[model samples]
Target: MNALIFPGQGSQKLNMMKDFYDEYPQAREVMHRACDVLNFDLKGLIFGNDEHELTKTYNAQPALLTTSMMVFEVIKSKGINFDVVAGHSLGEYSALVAAGVLSFDDAIRAVRLRGELMENAVPSGAGSMMAILGLSPEKIEEIVGNLNGVYIANYNSPLQTVVSGEVTALLSAVDIFKNAGAKRVVQLNVSGPFHSPLMAPAKEKLSEFINKIEFRRPNVPVVFNVTGKVAGTLEEMRMNLINQLTSPVRWTESVKTMDEMCVNKYIEVGSGNVLCGLVKKIVNAEVYSTDSIDEMDKLEGVVKNAEIAEF
Candidate 1:
């Protein structure tokens, strides 16, 4: 089996899905729907807007979702399919859409509301997220445990982990980790600290919003970030998505779990190569990524070869 993974934030770029939008009328229609649902000209921002403005959490959330969906439409149009799917952080929603568990309209609206809520999750400057390289997430957790505050936010990969909480507590923990022989510590440029208790406000609001929306079982199971396991039921999917805001993203665990399930190839159906690079490190398996129909065509032979090898 193979898993098709989606990337999260820090993977977006200007005009990221322009190729798809240009090639497919359906892809353009998706963008039009997003613009109507958002009441903002996302097409303009995505195609041509100020770089810094689009980086805002509110804009980034929807932008990433639309782009991922654009690429997804292109691939599905080509008849490419997957056995399982998973995504990192915000990308989880993209995975859900890809799996046919959520409609584009609902997903777009939910993420729009989600972004606005997350923007106010914590008071600006009250909390932050820091990336610590060259240390296991467990080691980082140990350091956070011994500190006054702060906590693990994202277990991105084996070597990259993020810690979030009060800035003071986080900085102090960073000092301790740095002194303890960590290779590097970098602060992220985010308004609110996510994937930590700092996002309680966002979680509360999102829960209410989620309850109003409808979700169905996915065509294929998705490995959730919060649980690091496959979500098989609608209730489980809802609960996991509700908790995802304030829960650490178990990316490494999810990737490994897919590998253990015999997922030997990974196809990233979205903007960046970040997830593909991480998969290469985690499983040492064949990985593919595409941003356009033309690019996706190149993978047809590769997927075919992999299927033959399995047989």
Candidate 2:
């Protein structure tokens, strides 16, 4: 079987979908609609030269979603499909659109608000996130067990776990993890503490917005972040999305679950290969990324061979 995955934050770059936006009418239509929905120069923000503005949380969320959906639209035009789909963090919104659970316009609008809420959830510099490498989840949990305000935010891979919390607690935990034999601990450049208890406010605020938008059952299963399981119903999917704001992303477990389901191929259809790298660490499967035109051309052959092999 084959699974399609989408990337989240930390994957955005200026001119990520410039080629598609300039060459394909479908991609250009999606970008135009996104700009109309957000009432901002999303096209310029994404394909323009201003890297600083494009990196902001609010801009990055919608921009990445637009790019991913543009790629998905292009892929769909080729008559390709998948057995299941999954996404990391902000990428989940894109996955929903691909699965027909949410319309592209609704997702674009929702993510814009979601980003704003998350960015303003806590005061700037008051909270932070750090990637702890070369440490087991259990060992990292043991070290963070007694630490106040610090919590695991992302179970990225066996060797990479991210922790988020107050700035002071994160700084203290960094030293403790390094002393406890961590290979490296690096702080992430983010606006707020995401996927942790500190995002409760964002969750509460986003709930109102989510309640207003309509959600439909996915045509294909979507491995969610909160439980690392497929949401069996629309209500379950909705609740999982709500809880995802304040819950650690079980990316490692999600990939493992996909493997257990006999998915032998993973195709990342987004802006970067970040998820491709993480999925490689978790599963021994054929991984491909389709972020650019050249990569998309290569994916056609990969998909055809995988289909012939009955993967």
Give candidate 1's error at residue 56 in angstroms. Answer: 0.8
Q: Give all candidate RMSDs, comma-separated.
A: 1.7, 1.3
For model 1 the TM-score comes to: 0.95
Report the C-alpha lDDT of model 2 over 152-245, residue by residue, as the tens digit.
Answer: 9999999999999999989877789998899999999998889999999999999888878889878888999999988888888888888999
Best-matching candidate per lDDT:
2
Residue 67 alpha-carbon offset, candidate 2, angstroms: 0.3
TM-score of each: 0.95, 0.97
- Predicted structure 1: lDDT: 0.85
| Model 1: colliding residue pairs | none
| Candidate 2 Cα deviation (angstroms), residue 47 | 1.1
**Residue runs of model 2 more than 4 Å from their true location after superposition:** 308-311
Give a tens-digit lDDT track for model 1, residues 119-214: 887777888889999987778877888876587888888889998888888777767888877899999987778898778889999999888888
Q: Least lDDT summed over 10 consecutive residues: which range in candidate 2?
A: 302-311
Clashes of 1: 0
